[model samples]
Target chain A: MNRSSQHPLRELAERTRHAGAVLRTRSLETRARVLYEALWALADKKAPSGRHAREALARTTGLSPEMIDWSLAALPIEQARLLMFAERAEDRVPVDLAGVVLAGNVFVAAIEPITAALLLGAPIVVKASSRDDAMPRLFRAAIREQDPELAEALAVVTFPGGDEDKERALFSRAESVVGYGSDHALSELATRLAPGARFFAHGHGVGVAFVVPPDHDADVTTITDALAIDVCAYDQRGCMSPHVVFVEPTEHVSARDFAIQLARAMDRLGQRVPRGPLPPKVASQQLQWRAIGEAQGGLFEGDGFAVALSSGFRLSPGYRNVVVVECTRDRFASAIDSVSRFVRVLAQNGQWVTAPADCRCCAMGEMQRPRFGETRDGIPLHVAFLKET
Target chain B: MSEEHKRRASALIARLAPPHAIPREDAWRARDAHLEALRAFQKAQIPVYGRLSERFGALPVDVLRHARATVHEASEDIRVFLTSGTTQGARGAHPFRDLSLYDQAAKAAAAYALFPDGSLDLCVLAPSEEERPESSLSYMLARFGEWFGERVTIAFREGKLDLAALSGALERAQATGRPLALLGTSFAFVHAEDAFAERGVTFALPDKSRVMQTGGFKGRSREFTPPEMRSLISSRYDVPASFVVSEYGMTELSSQMYELTLRHALNGDRAPIDATRRFFVPDWVRVTAVDPERLQPVAPGEVGILRIEDGANVDSVAALQTADFARVVDGELELLGRDPDAVPRGCSLAIDEVLSAGDGAT
Candidate 1:
């Protein structure tokens, strides 16, 4: 082929085309082995690249050391589950090429789609976010150590956003494009994809925790501790981080009282997983939100982390800024109705409650660490990204 | 506003606007008294504030936060001003039962900061009150127009800039040898400059010509540093950088801050306006930078959240806190940009490591 003046991305697409064909022919056993080995590589903390990945992710993302460790600890479990999920799946047909625009909110966030594409036998070309260019490389390194042939199918590239020519090159050739970012960014990227290209957009989302009154005497301290993790993990930057907790009133404690307990727990947790210095914008937003919450008759305590108790249904300005809105059973359901559109996960405590069909209801404190094969944003990852032949 | 409210506001204005510089202690005392009175008024009249005070310490910003969406008014003649809302679309609505207080504060602050030599030919680059009745900026410009009388010209209408009308007014002022004042948001000026550049138009106004721009880009447009904006204003209008003052105000507060540029320019001070340029508050307003988490005053020169005590805001809450990060320098407030909630921590280091790993070969 005469390739002078051809876009550089065309070569990248062409290189991945054969890998895509190879992926389709790969057995489920082969895929499971690759995934299991990759998981083992990630879990190997003694490995130099593994240690470097954790440190780099912690430093770049500004996630506390504990938060970084938590993410690293959770990844193996998630990947192992993905391994089992792939082993069970039979109708896996790989697309020619899949393009992924990963978000930098959390370092491990890049793994979700990358691993999903790998599991489904789709060759992926990832455009890593500038905020987190290290993560994709780390994943690629792990995969290469485990299965070199599988690693060839994945490509991670970094470029400044809004580069039209490069973006068109990627979109024109890719059978599917997955974008993770703010709603505006996702929409902007969606507009650039060629006709009939499969597009999956993950926009800004918030997670909320609903504390149902336990049948037994509630250990408020333990519950608060778990909720604190949900709030403090990734400094509440991830979409799965709990922004608000709606507590159902109990004989022992009122919803507002639970908020106060949650605040104390957050304060204690701050010492263990100290919140990193907030960026100027995040600090200002947290302050503004706190001020607004206070002015509106909400109680606010702005320590290293912030807690607000109000009747309002507004999402907390994430960065360990947690809002506790008091709600009865009826009001809790209604509040869910109002915020359901933006809620990605609803972490629940006490009794099992019916949430909006779209939101995933998990046990409290498990919001941030989603299990593999679980539907993210109510879309089953195993089947959602796969195309039927 | 009710006649009674107007009378109270007028009396407060008289106390605020002294012919000469009042003692700093006296100014602070008056401010504290006004704040206490306003707090008392809100607690009695606004149920939300009353509840919040009972729960949390009585901080005006705290009270304002609690009453963000609710209408908190002591009187029936209330006008609600809403914040532009965050990306999440949750706007904080502040109610003013007596806008006469707001009008008086705006007029007096403008007189001191913007037009110490008295109002000249005024050209506002924002929409009229009729066009955006809900906008506090539009309302303030309308008040300025009233203060400047018939010579006031508005160059923005129906959501568009009337560059022709602005150019005509500028030319008329130039021909008449009359000093002019151009007022608008920073983005509006950027738009005006771009428009003028497209047409190869520039102006050198009279010696005392001044420009007052407020409301930083707020991420709506590309942001220009203060020095950058001053340079653009200076070059485009042939006005000295010292004469291009920035107004710092928000809808939540009746009072405003202005850069000392106008005063410096009128005095023929050739000092170049740099990033260190500080905004001066009127005698009636006390501006302090407080730690965001503790809400305690930070040491001078340290960046902190801004909290204001404006005596002019007699009808509404007098104490307010804003998201703008600022620091006190030599008794004046130097604004930094809004505090970013989170800074990407060590991306440069990661990038370096990645490059060294030869992963950047792609």
Candidate 2:
């Protein structure tokens, strides 16, 4: 096929695939160095690209400057971890060219998928969400700044969702497409793909926390303080953000009391790493959730935060809102059964009941900060882009 | 129901019905007093309302889902009006001991806003009361058909609109050369329109014909703006844009609000139908936009969640907080659809999504 006559998407895909073949010939250490350089460039607050990303993400994401900084803190994956992932990924065969459909929910969500595909030695053409194209674009720019050759292996594109021509163009060029979005969108994308095309759908999921009150200590301040961080992080936009926390109430700490304390902690966090401004729709949803909370049991709220002491587990609308329900150990399993399928991350203080098989269990404060090499939605990060063994 | 509560219910019902009887001047005062009395009665008669009121200082309309907010005993002869459980499995139920108040309020509002120009045949594309006993919308449509419609044809069956039957009814009405009143949920109308479009058919009904569209897409059909809906209905049904009226009612409340376009057009108002499309609350109900978190009334024009006080809700909790965002301009409610359920911009599942997933739609 004549290069000049090729569709733009096909030309882009061909160029990226040629670069991926070149990338495959390079040593793992060289590729790791390229990624490491790009990561640090963004991590360095004083760097021009880093500064630009923070400000641009703040403007595009509606997140506060402080919140954007907090999200950036999760980046710059350790050099050692990258090397380990690359080493383990040696046997895996990557698609010739991979198509990535990035979600706009959380800007940081773009990092893992993009990195995973690169680690698997696959060139990628990413269609960034219109609502949030800043991070992916900035990340691509960062990579180009570090290594122009490696940057050729990545191309960031943007088009409105539901544009069939653009989607068909992508399908024509890529053997595999990885999507991060709501289930409805994922299903639609799946239907658009050709027969036998590989698709990895990272659909939306919820995170929940389980609080086991200290056996003797009356002060649950430490627990609430940490939980508040999880709630405020990314404005609770990430799948790992806790929407509800089921507290096992003891004499020392009651669920209602914990809700009040959590609300206070959220207020304090709101002052430091304040929540981003809520769009009118989110604010309205928060109000409706608050009313439902008020109806269910008790509601304790402050500016930009609410802690509803719900009688049953109710998912918060995110944006630093949370529902705290009281449950004894006996009723724990049955209570969580309702939301088990949607639960992605289960942050807990003590082991009471085993989490759902597919759910990731973590400590109270580390809900949003899954460790390096952690499998996302039960798939090894890099393996998501590789051929199934 | 207790004697004291019954007495208060009767008083509120009598005052609210025949909506014209409420004095135009200081109508808010009467409505406020009635709401105040109604709240007091709810506090005394409804246990859930009393508990929620004591704890939270006010009862939200959502309480209707958790517990019945009615004065009548559970065993008593009561009719329960249910909300479509779209969000969660929680379907809100408003129990009524006397359908008489509902009947009177329904007829009075429809008479003034929907049928002010006189009766027309009703072509309803929704389930009847016998088919969907718990649906407030079905009950209201059924009542409207009986009270004002000279001929009624209900074409909804088994969760689907019988478009063929609806088309036949339209043809019959057109043949009669008598005016018609078509009533259906927005989704139902969209279904009919799509079905008609596929068959390359459209209706040119008789003069004075109108369409009453209520409810939202609920993810059932494609969504359209108010102007778009009016245009679609107008073009497809051969009615003027002003004849496309939108009704806004919820199961938790007794009173329904309607767009003033039809009533205004009948009254010789020359304004464009789009400009006059704001929903008008009856004199028997007070609609206030209140701060969602604080639950306090916001400034007149600022948007807030609507908190309605319906005197017609004499048997149930009267002060109902709806999850709809609206603003008041010139005493008319400019409804901005239901407060949208939180959509995860990120990859996190929203509450509504999770609930719907559990229902197997995922």
TM-scores of chain A, one for each prediction:
0.91, 0.94
Candidate whose lDDT is highest: 2
lDDT of 1 at A266: 89
Per-residue CA lDDT of model 2 for B1-362, tens digit only, reads 34554454445445534444756546667667767777887788877778766534456665666666777787875788777877655777888777877777777778878998777788899988899999989999888877888888988988889877798789997898988899999888888888888999988998889999998875442778878888988999899988899999888877788987887888888877666368877766888887766667789988887878777777778777677888987677988877444444657777567665654211
Per-residue lDDT for B1-362 in model 1, tens only? 22443355455566546474566677657656655666666566656556655433334443343344223434564676665543333445567766766887788778777787886888989988888877889989888888864498889978989888899889988999898989998888999989999999989899888899998775453778778888999999999777788888877778788888777667677766664788887666777887766567899898888877766665565566666789987668888867434354211111112223332211
Collision count for each candidate, in order: 22, 2
The TM-scores of all predictions, comma-separated, are 0.80, 0.90
- Give the CAPRI class of candidate 1: incorrect
lDDT of 2 by residue, A180-218 (tens): 888888888887665677888888788888887775544
